[model samples]
Target: MSERTPFRWHIAVFLAPAVVIYTLVMIIPLFATLDLSLYSATETGTKFVGLENFRTLFGDAHWAEQFWNAFWNNVWFFLINMAVQNPVGIALAALLSLPRLRFAALYRSAIFVPTILSFVIVGFVWKLILSPIWGIAPSMLAAIGLRHLFEPWLGQETTALTTVALISVWQFIGIPMMLIYAALLSIPEEVIEAAEVDGITGMAQFWKIKLPLILPSIGIISILTFVGNFNAFDLIYVAQGALAGPDFSTDILGTFMYRTFFGFQLQLGDPNMGATIASVMFFIILIGVCLYLFGIQRRLRRYQF
Candidate 1:
């Protein structure tokens, strides 16, 4: 019998650093937060409360109102990104990927530049531009004779969340565009040639061939968008404050968690409650990812090509 080769311990050795770092930064913190959520600080000391915090979040009137409002707001935020940003990104990617497109590199770079900008800067700049008193948006609208359509979008409750969501979309559209663009470019030239020979060309080729192949990438982008939307705090906080106002109309879980953890305005900090919120967020993201993996991803048949 031939001698069996020694197990490749080198693979484990090579992966050890990454595994250690991820454990230290991600896994440890996650479990710690979960642990923290089970305790509450009292006058004496921290005491285990089990699921009391969760009950308070769901059953307490004020807490439940804020939580549901933020939850629905977050869902709307993700939906807006999914509806507007991804389709726009895909369309832009398709146009850029066309044969003999002029100045393609410049167009791509120009469109992607906003993605690298700091959230603070983007929020501040957009705030200035949308300021009702002296913003350029009003001026530009007036110049086009459509000034009547211009409202104080960021200031009004009805429009604040949508305005901020669109701003986020503007800042991040490049991500899905680049991801989808790469997916498009990775399609085998042989596949294109074969399709053309079968009289599948142009839009038909993209719809029947390229689009199917890129469904996996689109799915990835959707999950990412979902997670990012739920985790969103910076822009909302920067633009709308920790209360996520126009009367908390823009409040999402991230901002809610931040205010709870850090103590905003007159409210005192409650680390345990904050951790509970964080745990809820963790579970929400986990459930979304699991559904995508087990339900959606399995059904998406990836072609060998």
Candidate 2:
């Protein structure tokens, strides 16, 4: 009889490279960051300070104020995306999924174009377009006879964070749209036809049958948006700079961490403090993910389509 092959080793060999790479890049840095957060810098040199860094982050009034400001700003940023992005994406996906729609392929491609472009390009373009002095925003508003409504949105403290959040929603809406479109497409034609025969047509068909079936996709997208918004940085950084300025009104957790790690302007860099902030962010993401996986996702009944 031929010798039996080593099944476990074969599987391990294939997975080895991926596991190694993941550990080297993601896992190692995460643990390293956690370790760094426990230490503190002193005039004598780096020394163990246990939870002192975290205490400074949350207990010290000077640091706590900035921390909370960024935290709330991040929360607002996330809420805007949840309110605007997901629903708009679902609507677009539904429209695009309709049978016999003219130029459906073209429409999908056009709608998704912004998603493929780098955040840098989108940020810079919007920055100029929203610029009060030379931007097309004022001229466009003038053409529409609404010039009085145009403002330097990116430069104003009251509107800066919200404005950037909207900009991000515009760029990334295609992701949810595409995910939902695929989920919609996965639905069996026979099921829909059967519903049609039962007097479920058009709006009723969508609201009753289609929407319920797609809840899982929507849930996944919601969680993704939550994580993405909490981790947001590039668009805000590129458009508003490291200062996240107009007096830091636009600062979110990602920018907060960046500014802490590398330092900006008068602030000196402190890796230990930066790591504590990062660890806090990591825990926030972890908790959010756990809530979705255990709390929300468990309640969403998956229908076999």
Using TM-score, give the best candidate's number.
Answer: 2
- The parts of candidate 1 lying over 4 Å away from their true place are 1-17
After superposition, candidate 2 runs with Cα above 4 Å error: 1-10
Q: For each candidate in the order shown, give its overall lDDT on alpha carbons.
A: 0.94, 0.94
TM-score of each: 0.93, 0.95
Q: CA lDDT of 3 in candidate 1?
A: 82
C-alpha RMSD by candidate, in order:
2.3, 1.7
lDDT of 1 by residue, 1-305 (tens): 39898788999999999999999999999999999999999999999999999999999999999999999999999899999999999999999999799999999999999999999999999999999877599889989999899999999999999999999999999999999999999999999999999999999999999999999999999999999998999999898888898999999999999999999888999999999999999999999999999998988855535
- Which residue pairs show collisions in model 2? none
Total clashing pairs in model 2: 0
**Ten-residue segment with the worst summed lDDT in candidate 2?**
296-305
